[model samples]
Target: MASLAALLREAGHQVSGSDEGVYPPMSHFLADRGIPVQQGYHPRNLDPVPDLVVIGNALSRGNPEIEWVLNRRIPYTSFPEALKRFFLRGKVPVVVAGTHGKTTTTSMLSWGMEVAGLRPDFLIGGIAENFRSSYGKGGGDHFVVEGDEYDSAFFDKGPKFLHYLPYLAVIGNLEYDHADIYPDLESIKLQFRRLVHLIPTEGFLAVGGESPAALEACAGSLCARETFGLDPGCDWNADGIEMTEGRTCFDVTYRGKAFGRFRMQVVGHYNIRNALAATAVLHRLGVSARDIGRGLESFAGVRRRLQLRAEVGGIRIYEDFAHHPTAVSGTLETVRAAFRPERVWAVYEPRSATSRRNVFQLEIADALAKADCVAIPALFRPDKVPEGERLDLDRLVADLGRRGVAAWNLETVDAIIEKVVAEARPGDLVVLLSNGGFGGIYDKLPAALAGRTETTPGG
Candidate 1:
């Protein structure tokens, strides 16, 4: 929504909004763009009555702003609806979607196209480090977007991707997610199938072949398709993967022929899988292999995807948006392979709607076992899920113990910090994971480690 606001503002539209608990990156992004934002929602906030209200999906019938808009009969539409109507009509929509790697795949594709001199406008879920923003206003035919399977506004219950009109869609990987809206894996597959059904016959669907669910979702795609992965049989495959201190080098092949040798600052097999999907799309668009390699090298990656928040007394602190078991394992595997640190500490916050539940309990425990030690705080938004559905922290700790991983289920931010700080050594790597803000622990933990009040995170 923040990225859309920026894009709308850049297009000379007057935009303002009211949302509570706005956090950094977005809060800072809005302020940086000079977008006025009311702290909280109230009827008075809409007293002047704007020309139109783009009601967010998070706001429903009970929201004060929604109530005011309905009571006054003010014009209103969902964000995706407005986006499709205003911006996507005459453009080639390149949507990257799935349960994981949407942000990275979108960012990678966006950056690669930009480097090839196709400045396609893009909107990613997180800030792409190469662009320094989650959005862009490039003068190109493509309108790249992160295709979210999550529902649109309350008025529109369909997935947001359905409204985007995808000319070229990339399904990085699909799995059960957004448990609040989706009842099971089949529900999500239904949405993806719907997305694929809209694609024109001339368009393409680039899918991750390694994930059986992703392959299953795209099974009925009517458009041209390419399977990308590290496996040799994939239409787009990467092999000879090598990881160094600051780079991951791999050889790409297309249908058994050498496509290119690519090197990137991104590491781990999962991220390499993300690269494969993006590379296939670029190739389909006629981007030269040389240009794609250069783009991969230049792409700095998205913020909070194993981003180094701070380093205090030689102990490195990294932040990642890895809440799912697959994502957690990928992140830990990346850090272990790339850094070779003394001991790694995995700090987690079961914050996402799905992660806070018991859906992936055993999977999450196995993923966290990759770390030498683990620390997790009380689940965020635990009240939203029924008591029977909440994640079993006690069982998780015991499971990690059985796997030889020292685990702690701390109750507060201070306790988590104290436990890690007391044991961390100079060469160790500590990664904090969450989809939402982990109660400002990123700042607090760094300051506590430095014995100071403020410490800015960079690189």
Candidate 2:
């Protein structure tokens, strides 16, 4: 939403917003762009009556500003709708859609286009380090967008991807997620199916061949399709993967022929698939392999996705925005592989609406068990979920213990940090997992670790 505001402001629109709570880097980003933002939402915030109101999905019908807009019958539109009307109407949009890897894939594609001198416009959910911003207004005809599966708004309950008329789409991988909005995996797949239907017959769909859900979602699409994954059956596949010294190198093959050898600063197999998805799209769009390789090598990656925060006394602390079981497992596996011989401590905060529920209880336990040690903080807002539906932390701990893994359900950030500092030794890797702020533990833990190191007697 901040990206949209920035773009709109660049396009010369008078835009102001109100929110319950705002924080950096978005708060600072908006302030830098001179976008006025009220501290909280209220009816009076709309007293001046702007020409149009853009509603975010987080705001419901009962929100003060939303109520005012409805009562007055003022012209209002959802974020996706506004983007469609103002930015994506005539452009060839490459919509990256999936439960995971959307932001990474979109960022890679955008950067690849830039490397190819396409100067493609892009809007991403996370800040891409290459561009140093989440949005860009380029002169090219293509626009790269991170197409989310979440509902559009109170007035529009459909998925946001529906609003993006994609000339090319990428379905990285799919699993059951967003339990609050989606009842089941089929419901989520149905939304992807709808998105696939929107692609023009002349366009193409790049899908993850290993994911049954992804293949199933694209089964009914009218457009041509290409599958990219580690599987040999995929049209685009990666082989000879090597991870060493915080880098990943692999060979990409298209239809049994070697396309090129690619190397990336990012780690993980899922990220490899993400690169493959982007490569497939760009290749289909006539980008040379040399440009794609250069783009992949130069891509700096997105913020908050397995980002290393600090290293103190040989103990490394990293942070990632992984709320689902698959994402958590992927992150832990990558860390374990990249930093060999170092024990990994997975500190997770079950803060997302779906993570707080029991829907993925077993999967969460299994995923966290991959680490050498696991610690879970109590749900951020326990009252949001009923007791019966809430995730059972005690059971999860017991289950991990039964599997010979050390696990704890520490309730507060202080307790978790204390446990980590006491148990973690030199050459240990600690990864913090959460979708929300996790009470700012990213900065707090590193400071605590530094204090611990200073107090330890070497003499």
Candidate 3:
């Protein structure tokens, strides 16, 4: 929604928005663009009514601003439709859609095209380091977007990708997510099926070879289908992957032919798969292998996806937006491989619509067990989820204990920081995982650990 403000502002529309709470880096992003933001939603905020309201999926009819818009019969549209109507109609959209890797893959594709001189416009979920912004209004015909499977808005409970009109789409990996909206895995697959069928015959689909569900969703599509993953059988395969000294190196092969040797600053298996997805699409678009390698090698990852915050007293505190079980596992795998020999701590906040529920309770425990020690602050908005359906903190802790993994349900952010910082030793990798800010632990933890004055902050 903040990105929408940027694109709207770029299009020369006077725009201001209201949110219950807005924080950096998006809040900072808005301020930087001179987009005024009202901190709370009220009918007054809608005064001097705008031409149109881009209601995000997060806001419902009950929201004061939404109520005002409805009562006044003011024009309003979902974010996806707004993009299609204003920006995506004439452009070639390379929509990166999946349960995971959307943001990073979209960022990668955007940067690859930019380096290849495509000058493609892009709107990523997070800040793309290369672009220094989540959105761009480039002169080229291509418009790269992170096609979220999440709904467009309360009024339109359809997938956002449906509006993207994907000329080329990449389904990196698909799994059941957004449990609040989706009843089951097949229900989610049905949406992807719709996406695959929407692509033109001349267009293409880059899917994850290892994900049977993703493959199943793309079955018999009109567009050309290509598979990419660590699996050797994939259409686009990464072989002999090695992560050492802060960089990952691998060899890429496209359908049994050696494509090129590539290296990246990104770590972990899923990220390698993400890079492959972007590479496949870029190659099809005429980007040279050398250029792809150059683009990826210099690609800095998106914010909050393995962002190392500070190194204090030899304890490296990292932050990530990993609220799902699979994403949590992928992030832990990345850190374990990249910073080998360092004891890992996985701090998770079951905050997402899915993670807050019991649908993946056991799976979440299994993923967190990968870490040497784990900590979880109480579920975000516990009252919103019925007690019977909410994640059981006691069960999660006990499950980890049975796995011989020390786990704690600290129940609050301050308690978590207080405990972890005191016991953390040098060379420990402490990863705080949450979709929200984790009560600003990003600064609190580092500040507490920095009492020695020898700590260094990392970007």
- Winning model by lDDT: 2
State residue 439's C-alpha deviation in candidate 2, in Å.
Answer: 0.5
> What would the per-residue lDDT of candidate 1 be over residues 1-459, giving only the tens digit for each residue?
888888888888888888997777678888887788889999888757789889889888889889878988999998888888878889999999999999999999999999999989888999899998888989799999999998899999999999999999999888888888999999999899999999999999999898898898899988999999988989999989899656899999999999889999977788889999999999999999999999999889899998999998788999999999989998998899899999989999999889999999999998999999999999887889999999999999999999999999997888999998788878999999998778889898888888732343541
C-alpha TM-score for every candidate: 0.96, 0.98, 0.96
Candidate 1 stretches greater than 4 Å from native: 23-25, 452-459
Model 2 segments beyond 4 Å from truth? none
What would the TM-score be for candidate 1 when compared with the true structure?
A: 0.96
Best by TM-score: 2
Itemize residue pairs with steric clashes in candidate 3.
Answer: none
Those runs of model 3 whose alpha carbons end farther than 4 Å from true positions after fitting are: 452-459
Question: Candidate 3, TM-score vs. the true structure?
Answer: 0.96
Q: How do the residues 277-308 of candidate 3 rate in per-residue lDDT, one tens digit apiece?
A: 99999999999999999999999989888888
Every candidate's CA RMSD:
2.9, 1.0, 2.6
Assess each prediction's global lDDT (C-alpha) against the native.
Answer: 0.90, 0.92, 0.89
Per-residue error at 294 for model 2, in Å? 0.4
241-337 per-residue lDDT for model 2 (tens digits): 9996468999999989999999999989989999999999999989999999999999899999889899998899999999899999999888888
